[model samples]
Target: VVPGINEIYDPRTKTWSEGPERYFPTYPALFLTQGGEIFYTGSNAGYGPADEGREPGLWDLESNTFTEVGGLRDADQLETSASLLLPPAQEQRFMVLGGGGVGESEESTERTAIIDLTEENPRYRDGPPLPQGTRYLSSVILPDDTVFTSGGSEDYRGRGDSDILKAQFYDPATNSFRPAADPTVGRNYHSEALLLPDGRVATFGSDPLFGDADNTRMGEFEKRIEVYTPPYLHDGREERRPVLGEGPERAAPGETVTFATGQPGRIAEARLMRPSAVTHTTDVEQRSLQLEVRRGAGGVSFTLPEDPSLVPPGWYMLFVSDEEGTPSEATWIQIGEGLAKD
Candidate 1:
């Protein structure tokens, strides 16, 4: 597979096939929308020219129609920015955060933009800004419906000790950010962040351009990883995370699967989280959906949504959260394909 080409691999058929030929910049921030179209958030790697292929829009592969979404502030500075599909997949909202100017121009933006696809003319609106201009910022979705964003440099590649150690938790419901514990290591270019099964976030990899303020010394690749325990998992909330005792290995869409939980009374919500396959700043498969939870005599039960587009057929991490918003260590479950999906 090369640039501007998409190769689709089907595990069931054990074969590879060519997909539609479309031109997209490297590492384009693409998300799977419910209507079966791909949404390009205009966030991409530091390769393309600032004038082309950096507009946020819906790429309808079926008809090859590109509907552009406007209202991005620092449109020219989108390279190395971060974008994500907001939690509770049903919301159909997206957010794009800090980015740098194209091809190492030493320009960066703290601008953040959000769009709600459910709107008739869905265009991006300005969200809160970061503390400073940043690039190569890493973000991950927490099970508690908050997005944890951390570690980026103000310059193109931490060329002048410009790495920002700050981190923040962005709440979707409140549309605000609260400060989080600063990371010990400064992560810049090539850094990554992903959620662990135990509700902790593990961050890895950083390759700065220079080791010192002066441009003479070469930089080193950071191999040490840092695991962050979110606030929900602390303050005696660790023991309160709901535990799934018994359940089936697989469940069909819309089928009710019951499970015995350690603390059923405290159980409030269930989520189907797709384990992410992340590249430095992009994970196209990261998604989470709410499951219909029912309390009964034997135990708690969850019903997967009937819509195949909403709950795609695949293996997912099942997490049950308590009233305190603490989630259990994930249990793997396979969601069977529905008849509606191809």
Candidate 2:
């Protein structure tokens, strides 16, 4: 069986597990919902008609299942994209929007569809179609109920296939489209937007490694990253906030580690998700620090306890809850006594 689109590991046994059987396109952007469900859209149904192969759909994680929502998938829907709504509200259901399928007999679509996941029978509903047609664009949901879509090709066949600078934002409440800040360069097929802790959004991708001139997908790949600061989020005053950056790769036993946070803030607690070694399911081990937010000229720093026995040599994550008691960001730390030691 094909492995699920996005796979998770048990962490205990160090074994990995796939989500569910959703006829996923294997290479499409996936969004994980607050409810732990996975939804992916956009793909060509290799066996179907040109249009039949390209449809946008989703898969549920709890039941280990997949469901085809509603989309015009066909051979033409070559590239698919999906982004889960962040800061999801009770009234607003999970929202996913994308480009692909067919907008015309011989080409891909400029149309966008919204799925109301909160509905009992979640189905696709009409969303404001892109003012300009496009395909293979990246989508991201912001904290303010704003969905941003950027990059992608417009009118693939006739337009000479140049990258588009075009991008837009959608307001779920009004079901309307509004213009958002545009990127300096035109990119499609390889781009992604990530919401930053300061309420700004960062978009990366279009790496040359991921896509090429002949095959757009092969040249846009890159390890480089970029940030996008939204004007609407500026507060004039800069407040010290903590952002959990990427964590350690592996941890052995007895290694002193520094946590990752963009700006320093109070680090109150810590947790270790132990690898099962057998099943790989993560088992939670809570270590109480109850530390207070100490201010410094440079920034805040949290010191790990001296006992190396507290953590075994393996992969573990350090979750630091801020003074507010809300878990800020997780830092992956490896505890060990050797080369794996940082």
Candidate 3:
């Protein structure tokens, strides 16, 4: 945990290379967002001063350099603050939600902040606040482009009787939050949530120190995983669900992509979802984009986003949802030509 060193592993070459050292130590609650650029937030430790400056900043992968972005509403580093990249919109934006404040007081906060990356000088502003102060909660992007947050603790270190069992949904279009179904088990401290290919959300894991198997209070660990079916899935439209078939594995941004579908006329929407990089309630890279679709006799055509800054360069799962909101089995597609790091 001291003297943080950075390293990058090349999956193609099966090799590792030393990267420029970080100014501060990296730990849980720290998050990284990826588009063409990568951004990070949260503190270096549970309770302490933040690395470099307290504000979240961008990291240059090519040069291994870090640049601070200005105008943060809350510059003080907080523990377990949930930072996430919202679904693709006119401009790229990131949201930082509830978390515990720094120092021994370690009080929880309900403040929410936003950063617009498209601006010449990106800065954070106050967004819609949460229903209550929370930390260590899991947030995921839904198929409809909204965000859902569940299970967290009201205090730092997740002490006795601090669990938050309710769930909430954030709608960017409305800039407001509403209530959602709660999970049966609590997910605080070490919990996570990820969107599935079929559009359902799977959540699990919670390891409070004294609640693990080694400790006498085994029930507190929360071993069982749970899957949540969104209201759209239960709306009685299963018979009209679309089915995805063969398609190109990759293409560049703005390319016209075509794919086969069993229910061509029934298809209503096409979307691309980036795989989640989730841990400790922070998933900075999870994103989804709606593609413009045109239905043909035997297949469908869609155009990808023209801006590399919006879609980035990576492998994404493509899904076509029917009018009833049922999504097809995902087909993997890599976006853009691979960038040479060297």
User: Which window of 10 residues has the lowest lDDT sum in candidate 2?
Assistant: 277-286
Residue-level lDDT tens digits of model 1 in 1-342:
376788778978999988777777788998889878899998888565566678889988878788999988998888889998899998889999999888877899989889999999999999999999989898899888899999999997888899999999988999988899999999998889999989899999999989998767899999999999999889988976778888877877877788886567877989899898878587878988888788876589887877777777888898998887889999888887643221
Q: What is residue 35's positional error in candidate 1, in angstroms?
A: 1.5
Ranking by lDDT: 1, 3, 2
**How much is 285 displaced in model 2, in angstroms?**
24
lDDT of 2 at 127: 65
TM-score of candidate 2 to 2 decimals: 0.53
Which candidate's lDDT is highest?
1
The sequence of per-residue lDDT tens digits that candidate 2 reaches over residues 109-156 is 565566666677666565677766565565554433456666655533
Q: Over 4 Å off in model 2, which ranges?
A: 1-8, 17-23, 28-67, 70-78, 86-92, 101-106, 155-161, 207-226, 234-342
RMSD of each: 2.3, 10.6, 4.3
Per-candidate TM-score against the hidden true structure = 0.95, 0.53, 0.83
Model 2, 90: alpha-carbon shift in Å?
Answer: 5.1
Q: lDDT per residue, candidate 3, 168-239, as tens digits?
A: 888887888899997888777778899887778899898664553333453366789999877766756544
Cα lDDT for residue 211, candidate 1: 94
Name every residue pair that clashes in candidate 1.
Answer: none
